[model samples]
Target: MISWIYLGIAVLFEITVAFSAGNAQGFTRLWWTIATLVSGAIATFFLSLALLDFDVGVGYAIWTSVAGVGIVVLGAVFFQERLNLRKLSGIALVIGGVIGLRLSGAA
Candidate 1:
């Protein structure tokens, strides 16, 4: 449960990363980028809190995989993005890898 919260934070961190990437140049965009970076750091702190209960490796792997999945989903749903079978299949690989890690006692 706590690990899941960290996973959420990791996803938010990734979302902020995307936000920053989308607006790295313009002075007007600087506000958004700063907000994104600050929020990301805050989100990552919450993520670190979950490490209190879980092993560091498990926390890292779970957070990383969850963030990866979340970004792809967000991209498709929120950004009018296109994800063909190849991309979807790649995401599936991520899922498989996460599951494999869990099954192998990494989680």
Candidate 2:
């Protein structure tokens, strides 16, 4: 569970890559890419540790959807992102889709 939290940290840095992509140039782009890749690798390692009790396939499946939902919530609350009607509706859909995927054993 703690290592899963570290994965979330890496996801936040990955989001930083997204934010930097448009504005960062040449070497900066390369650096951000490196940062994203390294963090992602470390995150995966930790996630594996956290999932020792879980099946690899299912653990990854659940991680993807649940972390996705966590990201949106974090963006809205911590990032002070505006939750417009359309955005809120989209978030609703994401939540619904995640729920469907998890419960249907598709995740």
Candidate 3:
């Protein structure tokens, strides 16, 4: 559905927000801070579009879960962050929860 596409785009932008915020270093860095704010706005815009067709609770859970997973993976690959077994297990649990939510037709 078009709403799902919007949600996906929102997730990507949310991921960008996480990384940009990290690089912002307490908002001391101008460009990264600006990037964080801009990405957050874009992400919220698409999320709003998606929520027009989705249950708000479902849409929000999916958005945060997917973006959190994306941020973790990207952090490992790009920022030399740890990808330990416990974190992987947590990721799996989050994924399972998302799948369950989808199967329940809640999103």
TM-score of each: 0.75, 0.51, 0.93
Q: Give the Cα error of residue 98 in candidate 1, in Å.
A: 1.6
Clashing residue pairs for model 3 = none
Reference-based lDDT, residue 75, model 2: 72
> lDDT tens digits, residues 1-107, model 2?
46556545545544554444434555366766576566556656656664765467655655665555565677788889776887667667766875685578654
Candidate that beats the other on TM-score, 2 or 3, i.e. the better one: 3
Model 2 misplaced stretches (Cα beyond 4 Å): 1-28, 78-107
Best TM-score goes to which candidate?
Answer: 3
Please rank every candidate by lDDT, starting with the best. 3, 1, 2
- Write candidate 1's Cα lDDT for 1-107 as tens digits: 66666667766776677667567665367777787778678767877787776688777776766677777788899888898898799789888887887688766
Candidate 3: tens digits of C-alpha lDDT, residues 33-85 = 99999999999999999999989988998899899999999889988999999
Overall local distance difference test of candidate 3 = 0.94
Output the lDDT of residue 91, model 1. 89
Pairs of colliding residues, candidate 2:
none
Candidate 2, lDDT over the whole model: 0.60
TM-score of 2: 0.51
